[model samples]
Target: MRFSRSRRAFLRAGVAGGAFLSLPASIYRTALGADVPPSEKVRLGFIGLGGQGTGNMNAFLKHSHATVAAVCDVDSSHLAKAAGVVEKATKKAPQAEKDFRKLLDTKDVDAVVVSTPDHWHALTTVAACAAGKDVYCEKPLTLVIGEGQAMVAAARKHGRIVQTGSQQRSDARFRQACELARNGALGKVHTVKVGLPGPNFKAPGVPDSTPPAELDYEFWLGPAPARPYNEKRVHYLFRFFWDYSGGQQTNFGAHHLDIAQWGLGMDESGPVSIEATAQFNKEKWFETPEVAKITYTYANGVKILCSLGKGGYPGGTTFEGDKGSIFVDRSKITATPPEILKSTGGDVKLYVSNNHHGNWLDCIKTRKLPICDVAIGHRSATVCHLGNIAVRTGRKIAWDPAKEQIVGDAEAAKMTTKEYRAPWKLA
Candidate 1:
């Protein structure tokens, strides 16, 4: 796969921190305003048409105020299926392209749904913001902490609404649970327990082989290190590898840990120290930990114990306070005393959004921050990334949350950012 000349130049300008950030104001419309009629639908471009991408497209299609206008993916099969779904639903064929840059170049696309792999999220999102379109990027927001910082910078500088796909933030059960913790319904929460599923890597080591005919292997690697393609190294299996993702630590952690951060009201800041212990696969089939336990100590003396594949703790987040404890997951919200669930949260209201997709659309029109805004996503992801750092290093990590640095550890600090492969840079 090759980049178009204009798209290449667009990226170069973005890398240089020049024209991409300072484009004319006229080119920056989000396609909806007072001048635009109320009945006008917001046009969305779908990128990385994997399972999640296709599902998001269907969610948006259900709303009469939104329409799928474009679809992009490195895989021809995925792209074709996405376009077909749009055509079948709206009776209008969407502009299908193999490159996301071309889809961003389309004049009619008001926003983009980025459901690509973790490594590609930062680049596509920053570029989309530079190109004057809003973004709904999938969670585990960035591959690294520095990448998350770059994304936050791009969104702020471009005045764009960048929503992270941490949909649990919009779920009522999670909301009620967080409200209980935040509103003193739990009576000074001191300990939070978060349980994450273990990595489910089943494939054995296999020889590297030629890329699939329908897939753009090099492009899929993107900013990730160059390596021979393996059957287990792409698609769903990518989560188990360190090169592309941080396994279930970032996968389910992005959702569950995000809830922990929200319930603890640590959206803007994070823990001051972290310590972790992990055990990897005995057979060497996967890279990330098979089972791990991490402890994060916040400045206010709140301690979050995160266990991956640890048998004792239940799945999801549990806020343990002096009075009672509240446990919440996708299924239900349960409290210890039983009466705590009856309280109306005592006016310590949190951001209320029952629908994640619809919240992004609503924020696009009002220019308000979405429930899972990019900054919040970044902070939550930073917590997950820090846990991985602690696990990989096998040591306690002293962190300066205000400064966002790994205090006194130069070698570990370098893990916060990574060098991109040639021709791909984040400014």
Candidate 2:
């Protein structure tokens, strides 16, 4: 069914069996500016309270039109801490819950910012859409290629605005570079160079230990396999493990590769084939490649070479064409011969979002797709996941981007989606 109310209006209307938010309308009239329209204020739910979660939460809280309606985290302490932050800011306590499912079931939440690990992204987003909630989810959008597709389908099926948190997509410099490349300022782009963070074993690693009292390790694991508790495996360090994340190949690759896909005009499609090489630890300290060099070949013959570790092309994505090239990251964007960077004032259709969180909040009002929409994020994330698949299989796998499948090698195709543990169902 089509929606007239954006996610915010349905949230207020108690859509999907959710009750109306407890806060009075007068609460926001004073909490927000008098000049601001009442229809625009959105109460967002915060899920996951790790580093990225808290960072995104604070960023969204800065928006004058946005308020936190609820906060959820697997760890009790982190959940309480995030709730405290919200209460301190609004002088009102947002509902808190350990199970994210409970948070989604609430009508109080207009939209959800999902800052969970890669594995949780698809499930949470898909569930949120089914619940009629808009989503701002972190990248890489999913733990595997199929999950990205699933996310895109759910958002479209439910008419939900799902913005992937590839915030670099909203950066001015990145947009300029993509606009230039897209507008043909780069002149028939042939190759793109992508660089990702090299691997580093966190602090020599720690041994498996008892689960912390404040943490629900089982819930945190969720769909990921059950394993003994290890401090290194719990928080920031979880990226190195394949069960939760795809290492630098996906962590940083998700951002840079996304730029490569956007610049190459390949966000709706992906490479035809992938060939890669990687280094690994003998002791299996990590499941992902320690060092990897991946080559993704497009059906149109354009090539993107991504590297990590020593001799890897400098960090950031660089687009090279016959005329010139442009390289961009959060820090800076530089073009070859320097003068190519000065071109300006083009009528290119780059989604002009100066603020990432603001863009998501705006989309919740407009019923329009955000800068990095669900489909775009899925395609870009597929590019990163393809690199991992090629490394793991040690084979040159052919891909059919249109169908979102492995053309050959049934063995390789299995990596595209993961099997969730009991009590955590993607369906």
Candidates in order, TM-scores: namely: 0.91, 0.90
Query: Which pairs of residues collide in model 2?
Result: none
Candidate 2 regions exceeding 4 Å error are 1-34, 37-40, 344-347
> Judged by lDDT against the true structure, how good is candidate 2?
0.83
- Per-residue lDDT over 156-257 for candidate 2, one digit per residue giving the tens place of the 0 to 100 score: 678788888999988999988998988878788999999887887676666899999999999899999999999988788788898999999889988999
State candidate 2's TM-score: 0.90
